[model samples]
Target: MDRISQLPDELLLRILSLLPTSKDVVDTMVLSKRWKFLWMFVPRLLYDDSHQDIDYGRFSRFVDRSLILYKAPALETLHFKLGKICGAGDLHVWIRAADKFSVRELIIEIDSSSRASPAILPRSLYTESSMLVTLKLNNAILLDVSSSVSFPSLKTLRLVSVTYPGNEFVNSLLSNCHALQDLVVDQCPDDNVTILTVKVASLKSLALHTSDDRVEDFAHGFMIDAPNLECFHLRDGTGGFCVIENDMPNIVDAYIDVSYALPRTILSCITSVQHLDLCLLTTEVFFLLQLRVVVLTIAYENISVSVRLLILQDAYPVSSIFPCLVRLKICTCETEWLNLLMRVLKDSHKLQALELGRHHNRGGNVYWSEPSSVPECVSGNLETLEWLDYEGREEEKQVASYFLRFGSCLKKVTIKPESTSYDRDKLVMIKELSFLPRSSPACQISFD
Candidate 1:
């Protein structure tokens, strides 16, 4: 008589719930007579191709039998990570079975290596799953769904590498999610989705990323009109035009990474953002904005802001463009980047902290120019400055000397030399920077 087998039915079921897959739960039946039927009552099912030796047909049959025999009143979660089964079956049947059980959370992940056709989702998945709170689909085809599609309780949805029917279906799908708060759409490229428009009002957070190296070009672009959204993120490598039609007053932060720079239409809507991270293919992208960002901020209250910019065009923002920008991190190697840097230092009136670094593999000799005048930040609010991958180049030394000479309120200057830099060169750089006259007597300079 095993004492563990004598545990209460509720306690034994709880123990089985911790197992990773439904197969493990079923295997527990052999441990004792009491556990023979306890797994059938578990409220969760996780089926995956974890056991490699098992043939696809046998696994498919097991799943079919298990779902039919499941006596649970409600399935709180149903997850499937499936591999190709050579005409083994369609996923629509399994999804329908889960729908009958009122599954609250459903996750389906498909193996792309399988040569079989992508899973064609059932219409019931979009129109009937009112009880679902979270739904995530990966590598699946979402066909042209009904206009009446709805998910009354869904709060979070993630679709990655999913093929959509068209913009209308995408719009219809989003509009029907009455309670959707968080959404992520990545690499969902389709011929009919040239103008990907998302107009969800109830959405609080959203992330959109176009696929890398898309074979086809997007003729129109991407459009979004989420008024109540608080956070927005976008990574588009398609080089398509992106437009935001609504004023996102509730948005507190935004992160953008694109193969091309964003046009003014997209930037203007997110000017209300307090924190921003922009990664662009070229610095000329900023100049492409129709309205200067400096002019847009005048209407808002004087606010402090932080920005991280990864630009490749060897250019920087124009003077007065970032009047309220207080903190900035820039990664660039264009020898001419300092000109833009000087303009930023001269224009950002409230600027306090700055960080500079080389984050790319671009290699070439760099040139620096001696500016005619000191930037306003050097005389007033500028405080902390850090530089990474310092190589003791002449241009780098000149810039460092300029900062050490004029930064009045500066509290610290940290330099992290590149791994390829020689110790003798680093010593020389430290000695050269030490002699420069600092406007702030308390400022400390350290090298790493």
Candidate 2:
């Protein structure tokens, strides 16, 4: 380790760069005299209150002292987490100094409760042609930038809880940041409808999350022409509306959450996706049937029997809904709903693993009626079964019996019953069922 520290200054700085926060790097200064000055040469300076015991004012002073001591012309990265009550003028000065240093990666997070001032970034910081590779701002304001505010070296940009003047403000910012490859916007609101047009052909990743409470009347659309785009995440927290127009052949992962009224049209765009996570009320089951997913996780809340039947009716008829699904996790109550699920699982010939759980509420004497007195053979390829929140009752025994008879290919069974006193009778029942023999497969059952 001593020999490692004796390496060149560039190598030493590289080693220090692995620390997530500046305080962690500072604590290492006490290790030895040789390490005292090493942190000063490190290109990344990250200041987060959550990682240190200093307030905003003290942190600002630390940054000033560090800059004066290092006297470096540029920084590779600069991260600051100023609480909700930061001084506007102090923030402006910090950005101005960062601009002079040509900071490559900048992350500035203001407290969520702080009201943003209209003027935050100095005009010089935006106008200067710097080599900023990544920029992330939260709960801040974007001032007017000159047409010369072109970031030729920028690759990633993220804005969350930020305020913009109008749609034109956002459009101009995106148009100027021409070299951006990744874009993320969360809880950002504009005065008018925003139409985000992406001309950056190198863009590969995009994440958009809107507020569910504030509905914006914007007919939003993306004109993405990037052939190399791979990952996309779109969530409507505010229940806003958006339209996507792109044929991404390289996209491998996608997540879509929207109101029941707007689920189908948005998902119809991504026909070649492989992995998907869906959370919807029962009405959106039609859209769930279209995806060719290998892993499917579905969450339903306060769903009624009529809606549940609709899902079973569609899922059982066409195995193509989850034809490639090998792992399935269903979050529902241990009530009659299991009958509907059993019907669905009987059709999933390719399923290998199953996870069943009851909701946190509705916990006692939960009953699950089998689809038939003679258990229907289910997922003959299933090898593992997990029952979550199992409150060992007669209902649980019935469930175990159904699995014992129908799960011919099962090899492992896990019963995670509620953490309570175990009944001796239920324990004996589980033990006897574990030893049952069949020509299909030997199943192992355990409880926690």
Top model by TM-score, which number? 1
Give the per-residue lDDT of model 2 (tens digit) for 1-448.
7898789988888888888888787777888888887787788888775333457677778767766666557788888876535666766666766777888888887765443442254455566536788989877766665464577788899988777656666766776777888988775555243444455567788887765545533233333445556777776533223444456666656665443334444444444455444333232333443231111112333222333332233322333234444665554532334544554465445667777765335443445756643323253577888887765566767777777677778888887765564577557656766665533557777776
Question: Which has the greatest lDDT?
Answer: 1
- Please list the residue runs of candidate 1 whose C-alpha ends up more than 4 Å from where it truly belongs after superposition: 1-19, 32-44, 50-53, 85-90, 188-191, 215-220, 283-393, 396-448
TM-score of each predicted structure versus truth: 0.74, 0.65
lDDT of 1 by residue, 163-238 (tens): 8887778878888888899999887545356667788889999998877646434233567878998888887756
**Mind sharing the TM-score for model 2?**
0.65
Native-to-model Cα distance after best TM-score fit, residue 405 in candidate 1, in Å: 5.6
For candidate 1, the TM-score is: 0.74
Off by over 4 Å in 2: 1-15, 18-36, 49-58, 71-74, 84-89, 96-102, 113-119, 123-126, 146-149, 175-179, 188-201, 212-228, 284-448
